[model samples]
Target: MTDASLAARAVALDLVREVLRKSVPLDDAFDAHPDLGALEPRDRGFVRLLVSTVLRRLGQIDALIEGSLAKPGLPKAVVHDVLRLGTAQLVFLGTPAHAAVDTSVELAAARGAAPYKGLINAVLRRLSREGAELAKAQDAGRLNAPDWLWLAWRQAYGTARARGIVEAHLTEAPLDVTVKENPAAWAAPLEATPLPTGTLRRPAGGAITELPGFAEGAWWVQDLAASLPAKLMGDVRGKRVYDLCAAPGGKTAQLCAMGADVVAVDRSARRLERVKENLARLHLTAELLAADVATWDAGAPADAILLDAPCTATGAIRRHPDVQRLKQPDDVAKLARAQGRLLAHAVDLLKPGGTLVYCTCSIQPEEGEAQIDRLITRDDRVERVPVTPDELDGLAELINERGEVRSLPGMLADRGGIDGFFVARLRRLP
Candidate 1:
């Protein structure tokens, strides 16, 4: 194998280990790995694709590896990761067979799994030949998601629809961006399509940094589902808007674009810097606060508040495939408790007759519908504002009988799907 190719494989193996073994998020791992950024841009993209492919199709790849194994128990996690890497390339990515096998064996040797190098090479070679047929025979949906998540989805969405969610997650998500100005004008120049909700959907191309409007700050990378909460605020013109727990501030930028006197608050100073950078790029302004929203004083109540509370982020699994691997049931419970705290604090920061837009990139009702139910039932001052069908560009199916917006991955399957999100627009009584 070429030295350069081996280096690329090494980077991919490191990322896979960081995510699966160390429980680090893919994006965080990417950011922390100096080798990843130091590599040529093309190689960086390749490594990213390799790592993401392994994560997204891990279930199927593991099944293939297990089928090739003679013993019953699983290999060591590192060895298993190497096997997953090779199988991902062979079965899913259609990588050249020789390159896949050689690189994986090299990875095994370099990563202290040298004793199992033969096993890695043999299994991957067998997989390259027979993996497709094996994958076809297995349940793709069940194999692609973790057991707890699969059961949760089945109970919540039923059998067929839950399967569809898993299926959608296995596919790569397209790049959806929210533009600062006219969507139609940008769509034509960028070779993108305008979604019903006015977000621009572009074909997957090179690095997003190199995209046309990116440097100019004309738009920001945001999932179509994630952008909906701010849009639900409707005409924030001159309104005092607080974006709680805002980081990597896509929603905060949306609020600023609408001429809101926005105060964006979050606990991480580093992440808040990203918000400031994005706002500057777009020629927008917001009052940035690096403090916890649950305890941060807004001083005076705001006209509208967007609590994009942090949660398990299950709905975003399509985009962040590692979520299923890293986030546990306990993590969900912990996040739910935090969301409850943030929701209450958000209510305290709103004016009477003002709106509090509560949203989470989580399909779990505990973080979405159930949270709202708990809030309204316990606090009589809170009541559902009920999002109208027209506000969502006729996607009324997203709004439940109680009038909250629950967007699932399967909702826009034909258009490359969207993140799972639950948005509730609540109003405080006068």
Candidate 2:
């Protein structure tokens, strides 16, 4: 095996270990990994694909690996991970059989587990030969997702829709970007298609930094669903808008670009600094505050407020497969409680007659509809401003009966699935 291939596989192995074993988020692990920066960009992408394939289809990979092994279980955690990486390549990623097996064996040896190299080789070779047929018989969607998540999906949406969400998560999401102005102007140059939601969609390939408008800061990478909560604010020109829990600020940029005086608040100073940098690059400005949204005083009420509250982020499964493994059932409740606090605080930050858009990148009801439901029932300070289909670029399908925006990954399967989001627009009582 080539040194580069082994190096890439080694990095993928470590990343998978960090995500599955230690429960670190994949993007965070990839960013923090020192060795990753040393690899060529192609190798870096390869490593990401390997790691993602493993996580996104982890259950099936494990099943195939376990079934291929001569013995019932592997001895160590790292060996399970080693086998996982090899199996992902073989069964899911469609990596060449010889390259997948040889590099994986080398990767195991590189990890000082030379004794298991033979076992890995034998298992992967067997998988390379028979894994596809084995995988076909398996319920891949159910295997890839956690039980709690699947149950939650089933409870919230029905079994069919839950299965749809799982199936969508199995595929990688395409790249979606929000542009500063004139999407039509940039679409051709970037080889992108304009979506109904006013964002540009591109294939998930190439260095994004090398894109036509990226260096010029004409657009920024954002999921179409993520960009929606900010859009729900409805003509923020000269409006005072507060973006609560804003970090790595895409919404802040959107608000600023729409002529709002934006105050972006987050608990993390480090994350706010990154947001400041992104806004600077985009030629936009916002009042950046490093303070807790639950308590930080905005001094004066806002004309519009957006509370993109934190949650399990289970909705982003397609983009960040690690969320499936990293998050726990308890995490949803914890974050839901926090989201409740932020939602209440954000509502208070809005003036009478002002609009408050509450949203989460989570499909969990407690975080989205339940929070809004409780707020309207108990607070009496705000009333739901049911989203008309027209507001969503006429994508009426995304608007729920309650007028909230609920974009499911399964809803747009033909055009490539969109991220799951729960958005509710409300108007504070006078």
Assess every candidate by TM-score: 0.98, 0.98
Give lDDT tens digits, candidate 2, residues 76-135.
787888888888888888899999888888878878889988888889889999998999
lDDT of each: 0.89, 0.89
Tens digits of per-residue lDDT for model 1, 1-430:
8887888888998999899889999999988886776677877888989999989988888878888998865568888888888998999889999999999998888988899998888898898899888888988778989999888889988998788889889887899999998878899877888999999998765778878888888999999988899998978899999999999899999999999999999999999998899899999999999998889887899999999999999999888899988988888889999999999989999999899999999988889988999999889988899899999996787888999989888887778788899999999999
Clashing pairs in 1: none
Cα error, residue 353 of model 2, in Å, equals 0.8
TM-score of 2: 0.98
Q: How much is the lDDT of residue 77 in candidate 2?
A: 82
